[model samples]
Each structure stands twice: as C-alpha cells, then as structure tokens.
Target: MPQPTPDRDDQARLFREVVLVLGGVFAVQKTDDETIRRVAAGLERVYRRARQNQRSTTSSQALAPHPAIAGLLRITEAEGDEP
Candidate 1:
C-alpha cells in the first residue's frame, strides 16, 4: 500500500527544518562559496533525478504539488524568475 501524505502542519515543520539546516550550513564562516555552489548543484541533480524517476513510475498528476506546498512553490517560482 502507498504511504499516506503528511498533513499540512507536518509539511510546514519539515520545510522549516530544511531551511534551518541549510541556513546553518551557509552561516558557518568556514563554508566557502565553492562548497555552497557544489551543494546547490548536487541538490539540483538530486531533484532532477527524483522527478525523472517519478515521471517514469507515475502519472503527471502524481507530480502535482501537495496542497500544503502549492503556495510555497508558487512564491519560490516567482522569486526565481526575478532578476
């Protein structure tokens, strides 16, 4: 059986934890720009690979943003489009 989706509160908490962990990494004085760039590139690769896997295994609807995350995705996309 498929796993149940997390509730909105759990999703929000997870997002916040992700942000905090990433922020902490970047905040460290020893973290160099090159390291940050590599971290970002690795994350991009992971995201792309996961999306590809999902596409091969599930319908496009499975890739739709969970309702808890839809607004955040929209805001992030909007910010990403900004110069």
Candidate 2:
C-alpha cells in the first residue's frame, strides 16, 4: 500500500481551502486577484514536487482498500464489455 507524502497531503488541504475561498468570492460574483495568485502559487508548489518526485503510496488518487491504478487490471469473473 502507498502512503501520501507529507507535502502532497498538505497541498490537498491547501487546495480545499482555496476552493472554499474561491467559492466565497464566486458567490459574491467578484474576482479576487490576490486569492487567485495565492492559489496559483499553491498549485505551482504541488507541480514542482510532482515533477521532482513520484507520488507516495498515499497520494489521494490512490484510494485506500483499492490498488492505486485500477485500469491496469484487466480481469473479471464473468466477461464484460470494456468501458
């Protein structure tokens, strides 16, 4: 099983926060340039880490109780059509 790297987890939390703020601004139908810049900065940090290192076992995309990559599996008890 893979665990999330500390950095990535922090990024996810930060992203959630940003969304909250963005939503608030959107509710008022106002654009906050500063907020957008901050969000962009956060995304840049995430991208830099992703480019420099592979995801840890705990990356969000890799759900627990399931393998990180599902499409990699091509098996079934009964034959079924590919989605």
lDDT by candidate, in order shown: 0.67, 0.65
The regions of model 1 sitting more than 4 angstroms off are 1-20, 54-83
Q: What is the TM-score of each candidate against the true structure?
A: 0.39, 0.36
Off by over 4 Å in 2: 30-83
For model 2, residues 1-83, the per-residue Cα lDDT tens digits are: 88988877986786678668766875687667787788678667766676467655664574443462244243432235645
Sliding window of 10 residues with minimal summed lDDT for model 1:
50-59
Model 1 scores a TM of 0.39
Top TM-score model: 1
lDDT of 1 by residue, 28-65 (tens): 76688898888777666655565444434444565576
Error of 2 at 49 (Å): 9.7
